[model samples]
Target: MKQAKRKKLKKTHAPTLWIGLFMMGLLVVLAVLAPVICPYDPLEQNLAEFLKAPGAKHLFGTDQLGRDLFTRTLYAARTDLWIMVMAEIAPFIIGISLGMAAGYFGGAIDWLVGMASDTFIAFPFYLLVIVIAFASGAGSHGIFITYLLVGWLIYCKVARGQSAALKNSEWIAAAKILGYSNIRILFCELLPNIIPQAIVLLMTDMVGLLVIIVTLGYLGIGISPPTPDWGTMISEGQTFMTSAWWLSVLPGMFVVYTGVALSFIGDGLADRFR
Candidate 1:
């Protein structure tokens, strides 16, 4: 009876994991096949092909510059995937380390780490990112770097909480009593336990990155044009929105759909993690 109930519970929960996996797989496929699968040269501009609607030749249509929206959209996925990935990485490392230290040490180190995270959490996250991006003016790399500075604070807090929670656990106490080092427990035990929450956070943040990259481009602080960013495509398309609504709208839809799908997956994972 116990085994049967356990099996049933597992079956019920399986779909959520599957859905998250499927969405992530879709994102990967889009990113990898972007170049070859796209219909036209993303960077190729033709005044003649400019502002063409979805039709026999062009599926997503062309922008005002006659660049293929279809191709740009695909490549744009590449941008979105990596920026969020980078954003997560930058903060994950520092935050996790500080959090683990703070949680384990529980003194001045904790205070210092808490202060830093609070400072960032105090910032209007997006606004700070924009300011940093413009100040550095390092283009895409700069944008990612700047956001990383802001994005990791949440992770720090999560890690700190997890660390604090675990410090009281029997196994952690047992390790300490057994003369096991703090560093050993920190990496081997606490780190692994906290990662599920981090993964859930990563997935949710990945969805938001699509919009963030586009917004930066919209603000003229992200990757520039002729490079085939979806944000750039939208920016270019807006001028022709009355005459060539497809130009801006198509790419926008692609961004939104993928992002929403990812968000669904993220939220499900987060719930399961809880």
Candidate 2:
């Protein structure tokens, strides 16, 4: 039974990973090739062709400013990918480190970490992020700073819990008895075990972070103008919905596709690790 289940899992894993890779790879390629492949400057505007429908000359149509929608969409993917990568780094490091300390130490450190995590998780997650983003001001810098401040709590909590559960295991005890340094035990011994779960969390968080960024852009508190963000594009297109549906719909589809791709990757990772 166990052998059959493992074989089944192996069979399923490849396709899932491939699907995820295909979608994610497409986004990366679009971003990388934007300079070479985009038909027009994402910010270049020609009032002459304003709000044209999707067709041969302006594939994916033109926005109100007559900027090529397809080009803007492609550039938006680049912007989003960059922002997501930058935003995730600080949190991953701080959260995992602090979580390891809190869990492994299990004294005042654990208590304090618990208190901090509880406070952050207490509020509606999106609400907290919005308040922070709005207060920080409207730009990618603010968004990056806001996420760094609040993002680590989730990782900390996860690592803490996992560490606590493992701190009492035989191997850990053996390592301790062997006089392994705290740093060694935390990084070399325990971190390897905790990282898989954190990685899964990282993928899931990527989706959420992407949504928050787009939401901020929509609300005028995210990436600044002329940068080609999907959220900003969606917000810009709303006024033209009655006549220029493609303006909003095309950008929105990009967001959906990217989100779904990241989600599928996260799901695949979760299943593979399980």
Candidate 3:
């Protein structure tokens, strides 16, 4: 019975890592090729064509602004991808570095770093980003910074815990015995080992992050108009849901599909690693 349960659990988690990698790859391709593939300018609007439903010309239909939903979504991919990459890297770099430092030395710095990390972790992660978003005047750049502040703690916590575990390991002791520099051990040895774990965690959280960013846009608290964010698209479509379901539905589908793909890839990678 226990074996069967474990097998079921493995099957469930398999797709997460795989889907995550696929999503990441898709986002990269979109970022790079969206310009050529999407014929219409994402920001360009046509008043005459406004409120058009999904059709042959405009597959995803026109928005309230008569913008090509397909084109806008493709371009919007750029923004979403940028946010994800920036948000993840910013935290990954800072948090991992600080965490390594804190765990390796094990002194006053460790306590201070640990306490600060814990304090941030105590709060709801999304809430912190939202507050920072609003306070910083609420735009892409602002939101990006807010994301970094809110997200770094996770990486830091993980890296710190991982580093602590290796502090007394035989390999680490050998490195120390050989008088390896702190930089060599931290980057060449410690950081490299911990990164796979970080990547897996990042994959797991990417979808949730997408949802939060979308919600912020939907609520008018995220990327401003003219940007055509997915959340904002849904928000704009809400009033006309009965008449223009396509406006919201298409973008929402993109969000869900992309989320699913990334989640699957992430799960697969995690399973393989495990």
What C-alpha lDDT do the candidate models reach, one value each? 0.78, 0.89, 0.81
The per-prediction tally of clashing pairs is: 0, 0, 19
Among all candidates shown, the one with the greatest TM-score: 2
TM-score of each: 0.90, 0.95, 0.87
Residue 193 CA displacement from its true place in model 3, Å: 1.9
lDDT of 3 by residue, 84-159 (tens): 6666777778888998988887799799998887777787877777787788765677667766766777788888
Pairs with backbone N, CA or C atoms under 3 Å apart (clashes), candidate 1: none
lDDT of 2 at 74: 93
Query: Stretches of candidate 1 above 4 Å error?
Result: 1-12, 271-274
Give the CA lDDT, 0 to 100, for residue 255 in model 2.
84
Pick by lDDT: which candidate is best? 2
Which candidate model has the greater lDDT, 1 or 3?
A: 3
Model 2 has an lDDT value of 0.89
- Give per-residue CA lDDT, model 1, range 36-141, as digits (tens): 6776777788999867888878878777777777777888878766776776777778878888889878889999998888787888878887888878883688
Find the 10 residues in a row with the least total lDDT in model 2. 125-134
